[model samples]
Target chain A: MPDLGISVLFKGKNLPRLLGGLWAALRISLISVVISFPLGILLGALMTLKNPFVKAAMRIYLEFIRIMPQMVLLFLFYFGTTRAFGWDLTGETASVIVFVLWGTAEMSDLVRGCLISFPAHQYETSEALGLGKAQLYRYIIIPQAVRRLIPLSVNLVTRMIKTTSLILMIGVVEILKVAQQIIEANRTASPNAAFGVYLAVFFLYFIACWPISMLAQYLERKWG
Target chain B: MDHVTKRFGNHTVLDDISLTVHRGEVIVVIGPSGCGKSTLLRCINALEKIQGGEIKLGNEKIEYGSKRLPSLRQKIGMVFQNYELFPHLTVLGNIQLAPVKVQKRNLAEVQAEAIGWLDRVGLEGRENSYPRELSGGQKQRVAIVRALCMHPEILLFDEVTAALDPEMVREVLDVMLALAAQGRTMLIVTHEMRFARAAADRILFLDGGKIMEDSDPETFFTHPQTERARRFLSTFQFDNIKKL
Candidate 1:
């Protein structure tokens, strides 16, 4: 109502810095997803195994991920590891590592659910057809699981991207971090700049997330 | 199979049962729904373990705990009630998958044989269709031919026609009837009384985890030996056909 202060966002270094921040956010999301997806799939499948000890280990790992907050996990990876292991991790490295761990745990849980929900008849049919463990997964189990896994994992990726906003707290200049810098620099010159900058950041997130949710819906309709 | 017994945890699903099936004999296993009818076929193929007994299919005695079950199961074909075809694969692919993958047979040979089997089941033009695209009757026929392509010593069918629509039932039965005419040794678990009457050399009526009666079609239908068989057969709509 007072003054939107939309022009203040693009006045100088602010807009490009925000774009760079967006790139940083996407990069971390990509690296973490690419690394974590496969590991999560393996760990997830392993979690459903008949071995008691393996199940116990997976339970502990999944519980640790579930109970710990992402920011707390980031701090642990960044500062805690530096103190404990003496491995000085960069802010970006720590963010990537934290996201990878979080993504793996979430993706693994999704895959475990996908794997376990397969009808018992699926296993019976494959076994009855004389398929071995490898053939069972390669032919019967995995193909069926993937139909369900795609939509859910896409949703997870969008969530991981959104959650990457938390990475700014660990000193990575992601979108939210850049937005804070822009608002702080214009605090006196345009008191209304805070609202406009925040609005842009929110739209950026919406642009990124909407397509993913739409894809998830498309897959649900197409595959289900 | 001699003195074959099966148990789940402490509960015995199949109790002290013995069966001797001759080569080229068609045996139909019939019972109430929860009476371990399917488990017997599962046990025969070593898909299930027997608590205490031995099963000898020809010269190779089945080890209850052996890891080489796929090789054993390869020699024995089975079709399920659900028609569990790989939804991603087309009819030809489903039919040819095991022969090419498991047996390591020539792809060309398996493909031709699979096409030939599809032709036999009247699904020739539907070869490229996925399971989801086919009718229940077509899927069941494909499931049958998929097993037949393996060319096992004996084929086991577990309520294969039970899941089909009433209108679709005859098409699948016709396929089984032809298989019986060809004298393939088979163990069938089904509720199709007419099929048992028409195709079975012997009918085994099971109850409470044991064989209540094992008699030829003429004897079993006309005058069931046991009270259990009588009660089971009484539920059938074939009172008019119960004559030698």
Candidate 2:
């Protein structure tokens, strides 16, 4: 067999370091998802306001976030804002901030879609039943909306996990960054190691996101 | 109740409609589809904005311009044809929602009241069932009790039995008739002539957004005043009305 790069990966004690990087990426994604879920719900609800000024402001924010790519968002938060505002932010902290911003917008859009998809008669019924605003939301609106939200939210979590790889671009040393460094260091001696290393990275991502995908499918089947 | 007029962009839905419902009166509003019977009931609860009129519920003036409509709405309970129960909540939860959230009643008090209403409607055993799980008649009954838990001064039923199967219609109507016997003020929009004759104190026939005939149920059904009332009453062949 051609000199397998597997031995190379293990020989230099690089495996554990790669594992650590994977863990770091997972951690950042988890924190961002947790923060963004509720923030997304709040923003999504605010987007439905009847006030013209509030609606206009939320529309502008949603449109801006949708137009800008997440990479640009990361760079803006990590480098641009740090330099402009003169606030010291670690790479991990900045990655979380960027991911949350992106995730929140995405999740908010999902919530808005879910809320508006409900039959209009639901609101009329609540009004006829003498339900006040708080009662309407707590008893009627949110429960129905949440049923549709769960599957979409699981899909978002998977997206957040995969997108966490972008954090390595800003020097967070996540799994992909570690893989690159390993491949580069072994390039001259074993020129063919890049493909195998990328394959490993792909498997790692699949392992991380596969269960989330299953969860989304399960919720859709169960709730739909 | 006073003169109430409602317009939807230039289309008039209710025009110079004036009627008074005494305490414990059951007034049944019968009209063709799109004749604004539902709109008139919505106006009493201030759900629909009336362009040129006011509704006085007791001493309080309910107007389209007033912001205290929610407070007024609290005093009036409404039931829809579709039995608009909150799908997320259990029957008990539906009944207790307004009491706990809007009225700020204690949780135990709300639960007890909800249980009482459910029992009254013969839904005591199905308190935990969701709207999707209940039959249409049961859902409408729950909707009724949900409104009654708030102790509204007047109850509005907008074709409440119209959506039910023929067999299930009597169950809901029975509960409503029982409520009427308790002297609850009611304004019902219905196509059921028999229900009007059996339960209503007065019957108002609406046509083209105007009150074509308004009188006691006996006279309104037997001696319809205008040609419009006569034509409208003639369309329904009630088994009880023999050549009248």
Candidate 3:
């Protein structure tokens, strides 16, 4: 109502730049989800193995990921490796790598939870029915696990999207980074540009994540 | 199974149990709770590994935790106390899954066989019903049909009717009796004394992880040899029913 900086978004090219930045964040997360989902399922299955060594190793790896912060992981893959290993990794590539690693760990834990939720009799029944290991998983375990997994996985996508904001620290120029640039460019013309830009960014993130949350809720209601 | 000893941790669950089941004979194992009756059936099906000794199906020894266990299990179908039909699958799907997917049989042939078994169990129109949709009796019958569809050489039923409602027990027991009449080789563990007398060709009375008596159903039920068996049978109160 009174110079609340709402005029900043209507300015030339600012909205488009914010939308482009949103796309960048979405892009990194989408690629990460695409790559990590299958890998996570495989890792999840391995985590459930009865072998002490494999189980211990997977537990260590999972705990390592869970304990370490995602930002530190980004710096390790992005700056630390690029300098130490002498390999050229773009910010987007590094973001994808970090996101994939984090997503796979979280998603695998989700998958492992779903897998272990089945009663012991399910395994006994499948084995008694003569299902081979592969057939047992394919017919008995996977079908049921996938149903339990989907809603959680869709929620993982939203988390991944939101977490991509962290990539802005490594200069990825994602939505939050763009919002900062917008606020800086009009620092004097619109004295309250920061509030307006951040509000728009908030709406952008909510818009991106809201539908996915709805989808997860819908699946949980329908299948659960 | 010969000199089969199954130990859980430091405690022995089945201690030096030796037994042989002849072809087409229904051997019902009856005992008090925690007497290892169900464990005996589980060991025969190789669901639980024995600490000592071997079990032979015909001439081949059933190996524990081997790659061939699945193949070995195919010939020995075991039903549980609770009907463990996969909740995710329909009745027809549950029946046809192992035969079609594991056996690599034709789907149409397996489905037709499954439907036939379902019909034989008096579950003619419920092929598409999920396990959750069924009553305890109906689920047990479906579980029986699921086992029967595999065409196993023998069946091991571990207290198959124990979890059913009082009214539902007869229907499942009827299915088992029908299977016994058709000369199916079965190892049944149950507390249903009347059913044991009717369906068992031989009764093995177990106590404290050992077979205390092995005789025909009439002899074991009417004139149990051991004091433990006599005590076990007395707990059933079939004699007291007539007195009442």
Candidate 4:
């Protein structure tokens, strides 16, 4: 076997850049998740409105998001929009915007599923209790719906993190992108670096997502 | 209310059903299952849409189409058979939710009132317990208090004891009797004939989605006007009657 570049694992000089790349990836997912959650909830609630026109509009938007792939959506935002509008946009900013849009659509669908899955008698009880719309949501509807949403939202967070890898395609230089650059630069000197670097990348993703996966499992066990 | 007709497709669930409930009266609706008794109760609070009818609560017509339905619902409290308490909230939080959010009462005042209601229902100490933590009877009691905290002018019960264990039924019935004794106007859908006799001022026997008989509990139970009411009474077990 060829000499492996295993020493790269202990190179202190590369530590800061790796950590910085990891932080950037996390920040992109974190801010997008925060912005998406509330926006998704509001839009999901609006989708249930009695008005036919509004409901139709919401349905169209939801279907469009569901049918299209996220990679295409990211490309549309990062490349298509820039080309169409002649705008100057950085890769990180474009990635954040695209991820938030994608996350919002997925989260809203999760919220909608939660809201509609509640037993019909729940709304009847709310009506019977003399609860107004605000009270119905604050008390009966939201409380019950949120319990169901929690596990699903945690699952969505993991998806969002994994999908952040797609940002590397748009030149955001996230962890996978950094790993790719390092491996390519060292391929001539140490061809074995490819396997070790990719393996490290795999561990990085597992480390980032494992806790959220566990959280989803914990919530399901506790609530379901 | 006058000339209320509710239909589902070709079937009429409540056909021109008309009745007047005076202030401070207790009307117990007893019927075979699927006789529209629940639907009628639901109509009073606009939980079910009335295809063609008018419901007047305190001189104001209840409008199913109006955006003001929420406000109108606030005056009518409903207790469900399933005791649909918010599973995520504590017993006290369930009661205080509507009071604080809809009524916009002060949090302290709502909490005090919730505690008072819980005490009345014999659940004063279980305020912090979630619905899942409570027994079926306790959950129903909390549901009742949650409705009562809205301070509605009328209370509607849809088979409140139907879902309880036989042994747990009395605790909930006692709470209802206490509320009735306090002169709360109530409309109840129940299979408990004894409760109808002891607590209800009038009994309305429903069949095929229409009121088959309506009279004082003594007269209605002793001398049912319709054959359907008699058939229904025949199925009631002797042991159930003794318990009542």
Candidate models: Cα lDDT each = 0.89, 0.85, 0.90, 0.84
TM-score of chain B of each: 0.94, 0.94, 0.96, 0.95
- Per-residue CA lDDT of model 4 for A135-205, tens digit only, reads 67776777678778889999988888888888887889888888777777767777787677777778878
Off by over 4 Å in 2: A1-12, A34-39, A51-61, A67-98, A118-125, A128-131, A138-148, A167-172, A184-200, A211-224, B64-68, B109-113, B237-244
lDDT of 2 at B57: 79
Identify the CAPRI category of the predicted complex in candidate 4: medium
Which numbered prediction scores highest in lDDT against the true structure? 3
Better model by TM-score, 1 or 3? 1
Using Cα atoms, each model's DockQ against the true complex is 0.68, 0.45, 0.67, 0.54
Query: In candidate 4, which residue pairs clash?
Result: A128-B78
Model 3 ranges off by over 4 Å: A2-4, A50-54, A75-90, A192-196, B66-68, B238-244
Judge candidate 2 at residue A190 and give its lDDT: 80
**Interface RMSD of the candidates, in order:** 1.1, 1.7, 0.9, 1.9
DockQ: the better of candidates 1 and 4: 1
TM-score of each: 0.90, 0.83, 0.89, 0.83
Candidates 2 and 4 compared: the better one by lDDT is: 2
Kindly list the per-residue Cα lDDT of model 3 for residues B1-244, writing each as its tens digit.
8999999898888999999899999999888899888888888768888899889999889877888788888899888989999988999999999888888899999899888888888899999999988999999999998898888999999998889999999999999999999999999999999999999999999988999999999899888889988887787675556633
Task: State chain A's TM-score for model 4.
Answer: 0.92
